[model samples]
Target: MTNQNILAVDDATDRPRISVIGTGYLGATHAAAMAEMGFDVVGVDQDPRKVEALSAGRVPFFEPGLPELIEKHVATGRLRFTTDIAEATAVSDVHFICVGTPQQATSFAANLSYVEDATAAVAKNLTHPGLIVGKSTVPVGTAARLRLLVARHVPAGVGVELIWNPEFLREGKAVDDTLSPDRIVLGGASPAAEATMRELYALPIAAGAPVITCDLPTAELVKVSANAFLATKISFINAIAEVCEAAGADVSVLADALGHDVRIGRQFLNAGLGFGGGCLPKDIRALMHRSKELGAHQAAGLMQQVDEINMAQRQSVIDKTVVAAGGSVLNKRIGVLGVAFKPFTDDVRDSPALNVAAALHLRGAQVTVHDPEANGTARANFPTLSYASNPLDAAIGASALLVLTEWPELVDVSPESLGEIVENRVVIDARNCLDPERWAAAGWRVVSLGKETVVPAPAVRVAALV
Candidate 1:
């Protein structure tokens, strides 16, 4: 008969009625995940086409297990899609705002126009007041501001709680990470709101995932701090790589040795091409920008080095290319493999691989690039770069091959076949993702970061006795 019991009704009603807003990569994936966990989820989006696609068991992008998950849920009547915001608000007690908040131009602050619009829409149509949780990454003070807005607009004496539960899903492994998260974080002003969160993620928590609870500010910080730490880890290795390059040492070996220590167990210490994708690079810069505006100039200054190191790593790749291409890229045929910043994701935002590709083209090299999942997105960004269907096709008649992104396909490429296609067998492994011995044995000259060029053993000739 009370509001708490009203929200609790979904528990006994055979699968909780759930609604996820803004069904892009994050939302669509989360919606599918809730359904997989036996929740009756209604996925809502402003775009009728996207809603229709999900309703008909279609996924807009290329996630490995997403389409099948959506299909499985839709068949069981436990999942559905909707373009009507009010209908979703009416049926679901928990509405997740999963919209994007990209950085605003002319400043370092996050652009929350989309977040505001999505939040206001959810506020206007409240059937029975429950919880409105934010899963979007945003500026530190956003949840508090949104909480105030919800209170101002909600019906008199109606109980609607706002919670901040930031998402930590990596682009490629979103589904697995969602279903079996290493940790669950919930932040809100009310204990009741936190209880609902615990219930929602109860399965993961019971399965031995650590659940951390705090107020709004601490939860907002956990997301940004985690990103900042990852950025620092990457830059730290790249900085060492610079020293190795100057001192004639192998960074790959140094990384391996250093990684053996328990403190630095080598998750993000890749020595080549730096960090990128949808997060990392942008998030750190934005956090620094926000700190400076908050008068924390000293903290902002430290991140300046992190930013400098990542940017410099990209330039280092370009510099290596110029040196490898006979001291210039002037009219040389250059091949670029893997345009996605990292492997297994189609997102190309601030991607170092594409940046290198564009830079190589600017330096007058006839650049040809290829990636399995990212070529379409890459072409949209850099239409001038000649894109090929596969890695071998990209190297056809090229003077130099630049391994920019570390897709697994690049490893299995036959070095002998590549030798026959190029003007000379030379490769710059910017990612250090290839084996030096294999490529060298195929008579291809292999150049890589923080190490000397390797010379393969010559083929033994059998002398004929006449």
Candidate 2:
């Protein structure tokens, strides 16, 4: 659909009209969820390809339940995608800035250019009184600064309010999170703006999600703080995983015991290749940079180590892979399963699994990689590595296999079937998701990150089975 065909505001309903700027993962999900919440929603983006795909009821990337929901809303005329910012502002009373804040190429600071531009565009095109909500992850004080920027550009005598409403979305489970968020936060909202937001979020609010109101800085800090804490939890367990290897103890059992404590939950305690994705890695670094800028030295130091330990996990996997290959990985046919950061999504930004695969490829390993959903995205990111259609295809004629992401398919593969294909029976369980005994019984040697590999059985036994 052309910009001219975009839906105009429908004032028949008492609910506040809505517009979402920057239709990336966060924006698209928000727009669709808003539509599902019974609001007339317009999703705006500068990329025509994204707009066209979304308008055609197709999501550009993989997100569970998003494409079907977007298609449902589009068919009902409650949702539309557009490239024109002015049209979006002309049609909605509440505009959400959902742009990306990626880490800068040279610095730990986040790149706020897109957020600033989206704020400016929405502010400049306001033909009526409206609220501009920031749903992007950004440094504290960004909303206050954008408030002044919005004030300067808004039409004379036309009211515009800026508030920070940070989003907390897990990539694969975005639909459920958006529809029934754990909590809803609104920062620096005027009574009127808060009421409008309440009206906009009536569905999720009715679904038992608590709403938290705070000052702009606290609201901004909430998102990055949560990410930093989770990253710390992940790195904490991974750090223990290294010690587990040294002491020949099982990190998983230790994690389970620790998780029994009332305070320390089981979530994010998995000992594996450390956390990496579009959010955790960058958000923690951005938080650290901002903390240091504000003279908060301790937080800055803690986050720095969290980042260091997380990156070290990748090298740990590479070293283990080399050892699993019987010393040097040079000229060895290595199979890698699951390259996405985690499972059930195609996002590969700063993925630890992909990082390990690429690092091994650079070290002269003939790497073959597979992922149920991320093969296309991963291939684009690392073109030199071979892509396979399935797990068996990836493992064929391989000397060693590595399970990176905890995709269920890769975790539940038939050991006997896989053992039939590989030249050697060595398997690196980087995610520690496999049944070691089952693989060992199938005559495959299991090399996990933290757990000690059992002594190899008689060569005659391994050869006779497979």
Candidate 3:
């Protein structure tokens, strides 16, 4: 059948009415994208404020192009939001559990309470035969455990099947990732459950995104494994970056040479402040914790190193900044550019930029931060630090500047323009995104990760003999 026909049938029978639980980054984007794909989508969350904002076509957080998508679908009546889980279960035939699985406060393990609670709520309220798909990043074997928990609450003879369909959306490119994903993965117990998922992702699959179907545990492993590999790749380059720093070799040049090998392919090869934000850090730690629980201590040891290397990059920035300030930032003014974990989003969870900024602040530096999109979020997370409206504002009267997150404006900023504002001419390119030559020509001392700062020749002093 044609795509048009599929939507018509769905609307006629109300067969694929979709409900998304936990309207955070992943859930909100999925709900809006599903609505845009012509499904009647109801986004359910425990926070009434979030539901109200989403219902009014406003995205609570920043993701480029998401608010527009949400606004368009809300106007067309294809999308809505509510805090009512009962209302959601009553109307929707497919429930997507998109709740978060944050790392526990005191441990490396993932706190599965959110996932379990979301599953239990759906199971208790699933009044009709439907599919419960999990799109959250979770530990391996979580799907098998949830299946048993869900089965007990679901009514006998009512087909409420749990499926593992983990999400791989990047923060900045979430919309594109959801609409035209690199691939789709679905894990289910039976053919019927897989069939439901296939139909649900038919649009993307038709758009040339391949689908991988497997059993529950394998499916759960895919998301965490991908994150682990990416984190390892980042840390590997960073580990090499440390070597380059010690040897005075340029990591950027090394990464370029390494990129030529087709097998390596240079995606996450850039050595900088290292990987942070919601996914990589917590996911890898959770994987390590799960590996230990499963008696795979050797595997966990490697991941533990990955975590350590990632975190060490942040401290490296702190150490470099202190060195740039001549061993102390005691009452020195410092400018910081970019506080988001990465560009194009306002998520600051485990952000290296903020961590570095906070460390500097604690060291008695008057730190002024500027992020094109993350100032509000960063302010909430680190209220003691000062914030600026723009990079120039952040630079004004600062003894030194640190480029933390590589937002485009910060990357393209003219060193001359920034030089005109600061008290001293010093910059630390923590992200390795700036041009060393350009900053040096502008008469700034540029410090970069994995590269040494070159001191310019001293001006000849001619003593006049009277």
RMSD values, in order shown = 2.6, 4.4, 3.5
lDDT of 1 by residue, 216-309 (tens): 8888878887898899988898888878878999989999998899988978887888888767766787789878878988768877899899
Residue 1 displacement (Å), model 2: 34
Q: How high is each candidate's TM-score?
A: 0.94, 0.96, 0.95
**Model 2: per-residue Cα lDDT over 1-466, one tens digit each:** 0112122234534567899998999999999999998989999999999999999999999999999999999999999999999999987888999999999999999999999999999888987777889999999989878888887787776677888899999999999999999999999887777877888888889989999999999999999999999999999999998899999999889999999998998989998899999999999999999999999999999999999999999999899888888898899999999999999899999999999999999999999999999999999999999999999999998989999999998999998999899989998898889999888888988888778885346666445665
How much lDDT does each candidate structure score? 0.84, 0.91, 0.89
Clashing residue pairs, candidate 3? Answer: none
Models sorted by lDDT, best on top: 2, 3, 1
Candidate 2 structure, TM-score to reference: 0.96
Query: Tens-digit lDDT track for model 3 on 79-155?
Result: 99998898998888889999999999999999999999999998888666777889999998888898889878886
Lowest summed lDDT across 10 adjacent residues in model 1 is found at: 1-10
Which segments of candidate 3 are over 4 A away from where they belong? 1-15, 456-466
Judge candidate 2 against the unseen true structure and give its global Cα lDDT, from 0 to 1: 0.91
Give residue 166's error in model 1 in angstroms. 1.3
